[model samples]
Target: MGDFQPEAHVKGSWGLNFIALICKRSSAVFFAVSLLKSIAQMYKVFVNDKPIIFTTSFKNEEDFPVYIYKNTIIQELIYKLKVGKLNGFYIYSNNLIEDWKDFKVKFKVIIAAGGLVLNGSKKVLFIYRGNKWDLPKGRVEEGENLMEAAIREVEEECGIEKLIINKELLITYHLFIQQNEYRLKETHWYLMFSNYEGSLTPQLEEGITKAEFKNKKETIEALQNTFANIVMVYESYLDNID
Candidate 1:
C-alpha cells in the first residue's frame, strides 16, 4: 500500500455493528460496512460508468439484479464487470474490502482538479455545458501543481481573473471510458474566491455555453440537473457556510 492508509471507523445501529472504510485506490471508494459482532466492509463496483454499492445488508432493488454469493472472489467480480451489460449490479459479501483492494490495481487512473468559485456577492460560479449545470474544472496540466491547475482552469473556463484558491475541499471519484478502456478519475476540489466584475465568457470550444455566478436559490436549482459528485461538493460547501 506504499504510504496509502485506509480511513476506518465504526458506528452502531440498532445493536448491529457498522464499519466504514475509505479506501484510497486509483479512485476513492467509500465502503459502508456491516458486521456480525465483527467489522466488515462492502464493495462498490462501477459498471457502465455507474456505481453499484454492494453490501450484505442490501435487499433486491427493481432496477438492478442482485447476485448473492457466499464466497465471492475478486476474479469473478472483475469478469462480471468486464463482460456484463447491465447498468449495474450488486454483490453481497462480507470480505468486500479485500476484494476491492485487489480489483483497483487493474485500472488506469487520472488525476484532475476543479474549483468551487465564490464571487464578491457571495454567489457561486457555475457553468452550463452539455445541457447540464456544472462547475468549472478540467484535467490538471503537466508541470503544474493541483492548486495552480485548479485556479487556471477556473479562470480559463469562466473568463475570470484574479481568482484565489481559498482552501482545498473534498476529493471525488468517477469512472469513465476513454479509447475503449476503463479509467478512474480522481478529482481534487478546492474552494476559491474571486472579485472580478467584468463580463463572463464561457469557453465555447469546450462546449460551455454560459458561465455565471449564481445565488443560493439558483445554486439549489442547478443542483437538480448536475452530476452526483457536483451535488456532493456543493452540499459540503453549504455545510461549511452553515
Candidate 2:
C-alpha cells in the first residue's frame, strides 16, 4: 500500500566489524554487514530512545514485515551478528508481543505528541535523553493542542525555535512500568522540519544529557551503538519515505 523510501545519505568510509541492529516494536533486528572505511555525514534514527539499525547500503525494496523477523536463539544470534559473518538480522515480532505484558501489573493510557526533526540530507536532530538517543516529545498540557504540545516539547527538549510540522507520521504505543504500575503511552509523531540552525542545549533539568546532529552515515552506525527503538524508527521512516 505504501512505497518504500530510500533516505538520501552522504557517504564516507567506516568499516563496522559486525553490527546488531535491534528493532523495538517487534523485538527483531533487521540489518546488514558492511566493510565501512570512514564515516562522513549520517542520520540517526531513534525508536522511542534507542539506536537499533544503521547501514551505508540502505535501499528500499518491497515493503516486508521481514524487518521484524528475529532469531529465537539469543546467544547464537548475538554471536553471529557480532563476529562479522551474518549479513542479515532475523526479527521475531512474537518475541515481544507474546510475553510483553508479563512484567506489567496494570497500566493506564496517556496521550503525548512528539517531533522527528530531520536536518540536511538525512541527518536528524536528536537529544541524548537520560542515557539514550531520543527525539524531543512530551505530554500534552492543558489549554494546548496536540500539535502545539508536540512543537513545545521539541523546543523545550532541544532548545530550538520555529519548527514546521511537515507531515504526520505513524503513532506508536507501548506500556511503561513506573512506580510499580503500568503506564500506557500513545505518541502522536510528526515529520517536523525547520530552517533555524542554532546551538543545542539539552535540558539537563528535564533529564536530557546531550544534543547534536548526526548525518545519515553516523546515524546508521549509531544503530549498532545505541538501542533497539532506533532501528524500528528507521524502518518506520523507510516505510514513511516509501
Candidate 3:
C-alpha cells in the first residue's frame, strides 16, 4: 500500500463526515459514514457508476436487495463490495472511518474541476450529454490550477466567456472504470457567474449535444434526470444563496 493522501474533503449531503483519498496503484474511491453514535441514515458512494449505499436498517419494502452484516475482515468486505450483485449493503461497525481508510489505499486518484454557472438572469447553465443533463467540467490539465481548469472547461464546453468564479462550492467524488482500470475522480466545484449573452454551443467533440441556460422551472425538470453529484452541487449552491 502506498501513502494515502487527502485528495478532497466532501461535506456529505446527509450530514456525514466524508473524505476522498488517493494512493499510488489503483483507482479506488471510498466514502465511509459513521452511524454508531447516531440515528441510522443512508450514505451513498458511487463505484463504477453504480451507487452503493451504506445504511443500518433494512426496509421491508425496498425494491432492491440489501446485504446485512455485523463485522467482517476489511479485505473480504472490499471483495464482496466489488463483486456483489446487490444494489447496496449495510455493515454494523464502530470503526467505520478506520475501515474505509484501509479500504481506500488500494487505488490511484484523479483530480477534476467543474462549475455551477449562473448567468445574469439567474438561470443556471446545463449541457445535455449521453441523454442526460450535465454541467460543464473536465479533468484538470497539466500546469493549470483547479480554478483555471474549472473556468476553462465551462467556457469551452458551453461556448461562453467572461466566467467569474464567485467562490468555491463543493467537492464531489465518484469511481469510474476507464480502459480496464478502476479510477477515482475528485472534482472540485466552484460557484460561477457569467455575463456572456451569446448563443450557447455545446462542445460536440465532448459528446455534448446541447448547451443552454435553464430557468427555475426548467432546472427543476432537469434535476429530475441529472446525476447525483450534479444535484448535490446545485443544491449546495441553492443553500448558500438562500
Candidate 4:
C-alpha cells in the first residue's frame, strides 16, 4: 500500500486496510494512464478516419480527463477543462507520450482557405461566398496542412494553380456556439502569384457561379462588394505602373 501502481496489481493481499491503500494508489495510476492516452489522441490529422499528416496535437471535447472525477461523468470533465484545472496536454507519437505545453488547442478547429494569383499587369483573384461575391475560400480538410488545403481550394474554386506564394496572411476570425453545438474556425489567407491563362472557372459544385479577372480600376470596383477581410488586403497588392 505504501507504493502501489495500477500497472502493478496482484491477488492474495486481501486485507480491508490493504485494499483501501491499494485502491488509493491505483486511482492515481489510472488517472495518469488516462491522461497519457488522451494526449496520444491529439497529434493526429484525420482524413476520413485515417491520419495523413502529423501536426501539433489538437483537442476535441473527448480529451478532458475527469478528477477523482469529482464533477460527474461528463460535467466534471467539461468543468475541469474549461476552468483550466487540467491544463496538462501531451503530444504522443509512435510509442512515446511527451508533453505539449506550447500549442494547447481549444475544441473543434475549422480552417478556411484562400489565395491570391497574379495575371500579367493586373494582380487580382476572384472569390464566391454564399449568394454573394467573395474570395474563393473553403474549409481545410482533415490531415491536410494549411497551405496545401489553401492551394487545393484555390485550384478547385478558380481552376488555376502552379502558384508561388508571396506571403501568408494572418489567420483571424470570431467564435460562436450554436444550439447544442460548438465550433471554431481558423482561416489562413495567402497571397499567391500564378501565371495561368485559362478562362476563370468557378467551382459549380461549391456554388461558385463566377470567376473573373479585373484591372486596377475594375479590381477597385469589385472590392466594394466583397468580404470584409478581402477588402482589407485588396489594395496592398495592387498593380503599379512603372
lDDT of 4 by residue, 123-230 (tens): 577765565556766788888877888888888998886777777644434233546544445466777778887787889988888887776666656654544345
User: Which candidate model has the greater lDDT, 2 or 4?
Assistant: 2
What are the per-residue Cα lDDT tens digits for candidate 2 across 58-89?
23322211243233443343345445444333
Considering every candidate listed, which one attains the maximal TM-score? 3
**Which lDDT values do the candidates have, in the order given?**
0.64, 0.52, 0.64, 0.48
Clashing pairs in 4: 127-134, 127-135, 127-136
- lDDT for model 4: 0.48
Q: Show the lowest summed lDDT stretch of 10 residues, model 3.
A: 18-27
TM-score of every candidate relative to the true structure: 0.68, 0.57, 0.70, 0.50
Model 2, residue 47: displacement in angstroms?
Answer: 13
Candidates in order: C-alpha RMSD to true structure: 8.0, 10.7, 8.8, 19.9
Comparing 3 with 4 on TM-score, the higher-scoring candidate is 3
lDDT by residue (180-205, candidate 3, tens digit) is: 76576778889999889989889999
Candidate 3's displacement at residue 4, Å, is 14
